[model samples]
Target: MKAFFSALSTLTVLPVPRRFHQCDEKSLAASVVYFPVVGLFVGVLLVGLLYFLKAIFPPLVLAAVLLFVLVMLTGALHLDGVADLADGLGAGGAPERMLAVMKESQVGAFGVIALVLVLLLKFSLFFEIIDKGRWLDFVLMTLLSRWAMALAAFLGKYPRVAGTGLAFIGKISLA
Candidate 1:
């Protein structure tokens, strides 16, 4: 239960009990298993919102609303990662320099372009999915993406000696 709440609080902007926000390293590692569950919860919300707004708004507007809801639900967590990675890679130098670039507070040109491209891609896809009435796809997409995060955590190595991601990276296992 603690692990589930930890995962939920970490992954989303949705409010959780304050106690759940303070977790031990073990609980944080255990929380990996609940990532997909959180995704499923978000997905259900998106689908429900889609159904409720489908009749009220045109397809394009409905898609934009659904995309906005999804971004808000997760608090744009993944998007930050996307922008950071883009900034790092775009710097295009030694590994150390790339890491330095990524750690900077200000976003660079690559970050802006990457964010724009990602959001545009998501909006376009949402428009198509809504037009096709494929609501369930949204659910499956969220679920699988979070599951993939768990898998990556289990398989990935933490680059820095200490950082936020260190709590999960290399700590999760298939068990």
Candidate 2:
């Protein structure tokens, strides 16, 4: 039971290879399914925060607060990955070059643009939800986005040069 919950916990965030060393490719795919569940928690928290502030503030302000909370909670990990991916894709280089660009620590113009756009979109979506006073969409988006991230990772070829994600790839099964 404990193990089940632990595995479920990791699936919500980026899975660390160190913790799931024994997971084979097949189980990896199965494990990936839980990310949406993780998103539920994220959405719940955000909604709860919004709810608490609803009496004191407007939806727009609550939306901003929730967004800030999300960034802090997730540590902006996915946003960073999105930025890195945008930088790599925008480089107009070979796959190897693109991979290299992604590996770099610095954020480029593409990364900046991507981050801004994604944040804006997310903020707008959340604002809409808050405006309507619906929490369901918030939870759904969180889960769907994580699932989308996992799908993107699963479908794409793993870039060469081992990193944190490489081990995750090895453990992940495509099913």
Candidate 3:
């Protein structure tokens, strides 16, 4: 379906049906419905990579590689968000100031610290998961996280009137 392809293309770098490449209002709206499906595709790819390298590397290395691959595959979009949010939370005093901080492109000290901690946490958690041979958990967790993103986009308010999220948020089923 156009929706699925659009969703897959938008959510990840993975190739999808050619028709869905040019994203638009309708496609984005439809794509929200397929967010979890996109997550599944991403999860499967990560799982396959893990299995291929499982025997060839140690747990820490594998975890690092996995994290790196995830960042690459998703274009490090989440990291940017986390950094901005952390900076806003730490440095911004008033609500207006927080909004301004989040809007700025440059990352602050709080953002840097937060990213470091998050990366460390991700690496440790991933190391443990791979060590225990819980591949299924990895996939399920990936799926759940993506689903949560979709839910938030659908349910969360878009703070800016004109931004990338504006097209996808508040344009679909909000009930």
Candidate 4:
């Protein structure tokens, strides 16, 4: 009877207990969830804004709105990554030194150029789809781009820090 009660109690509760870390598991999970929500909102908002632009201005205006929306939605986090990674990789140093370069807050020419190109490409591609008069394309692009970001963390090694990135994703699972 006691064993039955114990099993019932375990099954009734949360399966994965919350964990705390320098970066807590719950907080990280929340961030992961939050990004997609923001992306969805951004995607919808951009499409609507583009629709408005199509009425009031040129199609090129849609690209500007989309670029601005991305900056707003990500708080430019991935843009920061692009900048950091560019500088680090472009430094032409050993791995340790390269990682150290990336850790610095200073932005360099390569970083700026990389960020500009990334934003440009995203905006241009998004603009093309929007111009085709398809609203569903916006939602699909948002899902695909965000999923690609999530995969980026999985496919790469933990740069210089331990326990960084989609906290719940395991190396073997990704492999």
Q: For residues 1-175, could you state the per-residue lDDT of candidate 1 as single tens digits?
A: 8788999998998889977655778889999999999989889999998888888999999888988888888899989889999999999999999999999989999999999999999999999998998889999999999999999999999888888888899998775
Model 4: residue 106 alpha-carbon error in angstroms: 0.7
What is residue 81's positional error in candidate 3, in angstroms? 0.3
Which predicted model would earn the best TM-score? Answer: 1
lDDT of each: 0.90, 0.73, 0.84, 0.61
Over 76-168, each residue of candidate 4 has an lDDT whose tens digit, in order, gives: 756787898899999977999988888888999889999889888887876777677776788777766665655554565665445345353
Residue range 71-124, candidate 3, lDDT tens digits: 888878788889999999997588879979988999999999999999999999
Q: Which residue pairs show collisions in model 4?
A: none
- TM-score between candidate 3 and the true structure: 0.92
Clash tally for model 1: 0
Residue pairs clashing in model 3 are none
Ordered from best to worst TM-score, the candidate numbers read 1, 3, 2, 4
Clashes of each: 0, 1, 0, 0
Q: How high is the lDDT of residue 158 in model 3?
A: 82
Span of 10 residues, lowest total lDDT, candidate 4:
5-14
**Candidate with better TM-score, 1 vs 4:** 1
Task: lDDT winner between 1 and 2, please give it.
Answer: 1
Candidate 4 regions with alpha-carbon error over 4 angstroms:
1-23, 30-38, 154-156, 162-175
Off by over 4 Å in 1: none
The Cα error of candidate 3 at residue 120, in Å, is 0.9
Compute the lDDT of residue 56 as modeled in candidate 2: 96
- TM per candidate comes to 0.96, 0.79, 0.92, 0.69
Measured with C-alpha atoms, the lDDT of residue 149 in candidate 4 is 51
